[model samples]
Every structure is written in C-alpha cells, then in structure tokens.
Target: MPSTRRRPPRQRHPELERDFVRTPALGYEDVDGSGLVRCLAHGFPSPLVRWHFHDEYELHLITHTSGRAFVGDWIGPFEPGHLVLCGPRLPHNWISFDVPEAGAPERDLVILFNHDPIARAAEQIPEMREVLQLLDRARHGIEFFDMAEAARMHWEAVRGARGMRRFAAFCDLLCDLSECTDYRLLSAVQMQGVQAEAQVDQINEVVNRIMARVNEPLSLAGVAAELGMSESRFSRFFRRATGNSFTEFVSRVRINSACHLLMQTDCFIADICFQVGFSNLANFNRRFLEIKGMTPSEFRRQAESRFGAG
Candidate 1:
C-alpha cells in the first residue's frame, strides 16, 4: 500500500492524472465557482460551512470567524486569526458562524494546490528537501496559529505573481511552510485503500441522497432500500467502499453540515442541532463533545480568543 497522500475518487481514474486534474467533485469544484481560479478561492456566507476532505493538502487562512475545526480526531476552536492546514484524505471540516467583519472579505480565503509540484521541485533543490519531508507528514495535515501572517505573506506572493513566476512563488511558500517548527500534524495518515474495482460513481448516488436529506432524519436501511440494495449488503458495501460505517460516516457528514451553520448564523445550538439532524439537546451535546472534544461553549470561547488577537 502506498503511504503518500493520493486517493482517486471513484468518478476518477487514478492512472489518468488528467481525469482527476479537473475539480472532479460536483458543486464543490476542485477550484471554485468562477473556474478562472487557478487555485480555489471561496468566501462562504457566514453560515455556509461544508465538512469535506479531498486528495490535496489545503491551506485555510481564516479571517473574521471563530469556531471549532475538526481535523481527524483532533478538534479545537479557532477564529478570524486561524491557520488551518488540512492533511490530504483526512475526514475533516471547519465550523464557523457569522464572523464579525474585520475590514477584510467576509469569506475566508481557501487556497488549494497540488502536492506534485513540490515533489518535483524538491528533487532539484536541497534547500527544500526538508520541506518535502514535512509534506509527507502533511499528508495527515497541519495547523498554525498566529501564523497566517507568515503564510499570508507567502500567499500574497503567490496570489499576485504571474506566469511561471506565480508557480515559483508558490514553491517558495512550500519551502517556507517546511521551515516552520511550530506547526502540528493532524495525525500520521490513517487512510484506507480504495478498492480497485469499487463503483464510486454509482455510489455518489448514495452520497447525493445523504447530502440532500442531511437535515432530515435518514437511516441506512431507508437509504439502502431507496438504492435498491438489501440492508445488510448495503451496510457492508458502504463500509468496505468508504472506510467508514453508515452510522459513523453519516454522523461525520452531519457534523460537517453543522459546521457550516455554526460559522454562518447566530442561531442557538438547539436550533443548529435540529438543523443538522439531532433532535435532542443532550444527544447533540454528547455528539459534539465526543466528535469535537470540546463543549460547544468552550469551542466558541477558544475561537473568540484566537480571533480577538487577530
């Protein structure tokens, strides 16, 4: 089993880089809505959060919102001043609510770039050899606090450059990241292998069902029935295919939906709970604390603190 971060979604052909090169996911383009973005740039409304992971290491320089960020098994609060570096293939998401505007764009700048270029550059430069090592760890992800400025400086360079210069600037940014000692890896990559003959595109139909009825009560049995599969078979099929069980997988996905609400609205937890499919307050609290490892209030407090300094 290869250990470096690379998982071709079922819709894509792993052997064909071009097939996965395009933003393969529906709605959430690898880039974004404009399509002109060489890198993805999205500014979500205060409440529009999505809990999703991808095949690339992502740098999220958050400004003007504070909330809990769930990366793998680690969860903590962050704010306008947060730097969330998500590892490739980890099931993670960030939750924020209407962050008070801080004279910057309301939507945070989410920059996505492929790891291959860094791999290419390191082969030619000894200065970046260590950086390559860091990236291998980054397959699990990393996070920095009070460090977006350092990253912002790098990002500004990348965002402003033109032609090959832009590409070079981005390379330099990776080197800069490699040099930082304060960074934390989310965890060593613990991803499962994709089945060689798995029918991923067909399964998206199931994923689509979850996405559409996320807020409503959804059961694995019902979903399987809708998909014309037997309950027991669907259970086994989902687990083998996704590296996740239907219940836990659905909960992970629901948490992601909750994150969007947390960042975009002033709605109370109870309301947000219902909005994300939990009907009881105790259950919501239990799940949030278990999944996020912080009480919602504590999570909020930490986020505010992080943003306060920013």
Candidate 2:
C-alpha cells in the first residue's frame, strides 16, 4: 500500500565538495603548507546535503543560518549562529535545508585541523586526558554553544595568521573551547551504541537514493538490491537503525519535502504531493498530519499566518 505519513529528512549534496584541500596525512599543504599547523578552511554555503566525514577536528562558526542540524544520529532544530566542533571519522551532516525558508546562509568561518597532533597534545597531560577523550567522541561530532563572538574571533585569528604564530593562536582557540561549559556532544555513537554512526550513514545513503527517485513506486526487494542487501536483512537493519520502518521513513521524507515546497515555493499542494514522491493527495494529507500534528491545509494556513506576522 502507498504511504500515508510525512517523511523525515534525507541526505543532500551526496559528495564532499571542499573548495580547499586539507587531508590528515598531507595536512593543509594542499592549500598553504608553509606552517606546521596545516589544514584550515572556511565555508558559508546554502544548506544542502552530502553526508561524509573526515579524520580532522572541524570547528564551524555559522553566523546567521539555522535549521534541522543533524550531527551523526543527533537531530534537532538549531538556532542561528551555531558553532560546532566535530572530531574525526564521525559521519555528520546538516538538514537545515529542509526547514521552510531557513534563515540566512551568511557565515563567518569554518576551521578544520588534522586530529593527530591535537590528540598527541592531549596525550601528554593526565589532567587534560578527559579532554582528549572528548576529542575521541568528537569523532562522532560535537555541537557547541551558539554565536560565541569569541569563538568566531578565534576562527578569524587562526585563519588570518601564518607560521608558529598561527599554531599558537589555534591552541588559544582550543583552550577557550575546552573552558566552555555550555555545549552538547552529538551522535549516540559517541556515548553508546558503538555502531550507531555507521548504521545512520547506511540508512541515510538509502534515504538519499529514495529521495532521488521519489516519484516512482519503491519496493523492499528493489531497495535491498540497490544496497546489495537481502530484503529481510535490510528490513531489520533499517528498523533498528532509524526506529522507523522503511515505509515510515519514505513517507516522512516525501511529505516533509512537500511541506517545504508549500512554505518556500508557490507550488500548488496537489503538485507538491507528487513532487515530493507521493502518488496522490489523500495519502499526502494523512501523512502530513501525522508528522506535523496538523492537516496539510492547516499547516499552510498556520505558516501563512506566521509569515504575515513576521
């Protein structure tokens, strides 16, 4: 039977499109390798998906953008001016694009540093050992305090300098971060569920493909075949990973996309239903209500009311 529920978020971009090169082994040599402190790049792009991870410590200073920020399996509605520190190999991505008319995309800086030296530095002191352990969990990702003018200043300082002076400034930035008390670590894999990150990534990849083919009928066997897994195994794995059956996941994604279109674009509701992968209106209306706690028309009315107020 066709789905009758709103779909949740799905992957975007689908590839790491870095403007600067900063690998762990080569460090920032790909960009400017004159100093020992290699690997620092900044970004401020419109919200899009392409979930991937790297072996580096990443500091993001989002100046004026907010949405459903997904760091690993940790998902939430983030406010503007968000700062996050993600450790190595922990799959993470932002779903801010899914929000209807998400705020500004203008950002200040994004800093990425190879993890080896930072790990080695924390290894020397027993007292700071926990902080190093924190870095390990960062492998799963960290969502730190918002705005944080000081953190933004630090990012600017590290990126604007060179030589040993730059390294010292980077250290200062970390010290300030370590002293911060109001921050939250992301990804359940960081604290528990050892395979959580991998599981989420697998589900996300599947979800991305689903998004790419939203208009067509999806079959369990077909999806499993695409991912090279047997139908039964895929079913179990997906359920355990997302706590939603495959049917529920797809429905949520389609309807959520429909809602985004309704609020952000001038598309008709009937058009949006199919555009987001649903086959018809009844299913879309039912699913939209399930996920959003309101009917589709009600959702549109409320959104219009809010928009008018703003």
Candidate 3:
C-alpha cells in the first residue's frame, strides 16, 4: 500500500482542503425558554460534560478542580480559575482528575450565546465594537490566563440576575473579556464551520448515541432504520449536518478513542482493535493507518515516547 502517513503540502487540491477540515460533533443545549444568553453550572462527570460543540459561543469558567482540557487537537492542563472562550463549532471537553474523597463536585460555570446576536449589537452600539475582533479570534478557542476575579463576578451575576439586569451584565462581561491581553489561542487547526441550528439537536442526539456504542458493531443502515429514516436519506442528512459521511465520522471517532487507549493502557493491538469494534486486525490496521497516519504499534511507540509508557 502507498504511504498515507505524511501530511500533504499546504497547496493541495481545493477538494482536499475541504476533506482536511474536520467538523466538531454538534452539541445541543435547550435555551429557547431562557434569555438571549444561557448561564448554567455543571458538575464533573455529568452527561453535559463531553467532547462536543454547538452553534453558540461559550464563555467557560473552571470554578473547581484541576485536570486536562481538550480543545480541537490541543490537550493541556487546566486548574480552578481557568477561563476560556470557544467560538461556534469548536470541539472541547474538560476531564477532571478524580478525587475519591471529594467526589465529583460542581466544577464549571458556563455562559452560551449566539454569534449573530452579539455581532448585531456591536453594529448598533460602537462601544461593543471591540468585542467583535475578540469573537473573531475565538474561532481557534481562547484561554484567558488572567482576569479570574472579573470572570468569577460576571459568571455569578449572569446566573443570579434576571430581566434587563442579566442582559446588561452579560454584555459587560464580554466587554471585560474583550479588553484582556493575557490570553492565547488553543487549537492549531481551524475547524469547519457551523451547521443549521434547527438540525443540531437531532444530529447531537444521533452523535451521542454513536459515541455511546462506538465499541459495538454499528451500522449506518441500522441507525437509519432506528430513526425511521431511509438509508439514503439518513446518509445525506448526516453528511450535510456533520460534514462527514457516517462511515468516515465513525472511523475518526474510533481512531481517536484508540489513541487514548494506546497512551493509557497496556492492552495488545489486537485487543484494542476488538475493543474499538473492528471485526478483524487487518481492517483495523488499515483504517487506523488512513486516519492516524501510522500503524497501531508505531503510534503506541510515539505516544509512549512523548508521554512515557503507562
């Protein structure tokens, strides 16, 4: 087989560029009954806490505990007082270190709102203009290294206040964050754009189901049938909503999970292949090579070299 392990040059075909753009999985949050901005607190290990994205911009504050934060392809340490802004369609998740004694406590305070609402407000109010640039930069995910106190105050205010007071506080919070200088972009690669919001909840539900049973023998036709959709209709809908065909998306997710297993466990390659739902070793190796650029053994060696053998 030809070597598929190399990263292609920047100047490839236009079609290849689109193929390289991997859209993050959609996350659907019900905020219709709430105000323009939705403020909520979540505990660690909750169902809401997962590797997913949405159509709204997220202002996330790490209130308690310390652990790893995954944004796009970047993985790094995060602690209490950590603050970040993830633009629409940026896949992110924070996995906290388990403290058996303390248990899983409420760890994050988050505010989510749409891009257009803030942009339109900026057009009408010149003082809000500064936040426009900040929002643009958030496409790669922004981590604020300073302004912990300001973030904490605004997070609490937005959660507690109602009516116009909450709206004003929310705007002020954006103004404060927009002026901050101590921040860095997290993701190396730019993400594919957002999809239709109306379809997001349904797509998220289907994606969540796929994630839950990734290690089992999953079939596209079966899932389509379960949703009471024809196979062709479901395939087209999934591609339009997620920017990837069902098979390609599932393989990517499976390979990503396999990478974690390779780094964290001592399981044999064949065992991992089976664990990730591949029927045979050869098929698993082939798919893994296409998505991950390296064979299973090579990936393990490289991962262990950088992170140390677990």
Winning model by TM-score: 3
Best by lDDT: 3
> Could you give candidate 2's per-residue lDDT for residues 191-302 as a string of tens digits?
2232767776787787778778877798888999988999999998877765678888777667656655654455668877888778768988888877766776665554
What would the per-residue lDDT of candidate 3 be over residues 1-310, giving only the tens digit for each residue? 8887645322211011111122222122244444788776767656565566777788888878887676654566788889999888876778777434655567878888888877888789898788887887798789998777789899888877777898988888988888888888775422233457767777877888877998997889999999889999999888877678998888877776776677557777888888887888999999888775678898766543222112
Q: What is the lDDT of candidate 2?
A: 0.61
Better of 2 and 3 by lDDT: 3
| Runs of candidate 1 exceeding 4 Å displacement | 1-38, 46-48, 98-105, 188-310
TM-scores of the candidates are 0.48, 0.48, 0.53
Candidate 2 accuracy as TM-score: 0.48
Please list the C-alpha lDDT of all candidates, in the order they appear.
Answer: 0.61, 0.61, 0.73
On lDDT, who's better, 1 or 3?
3
Q: How far is candidate 2 from the true structure (C-alpha RMSD, Å)?
A: 11.3
Q: In candidate 3, which residue pairs get closer than 3 Å at backbone N, Cα or C atoms, i.e. clash? A: none
Give a tens-digit lDDT track for model 1, residues 1-310.
Answer: 8699545322211121132534433223443332222444345442224445566677777766666665654556667667766655655556665554552244465656567766776789776577666666666667864577777777667676666777677767776676777866553222243445446654667777877888888998898888889999999888876678888877776766665455434557777788888788798888777766676666544433222222
Better of 1 and 3 by TM-score: 3
The whole-model C-alpha lDDT of candidate 3 against the native structure comes to: 0.73
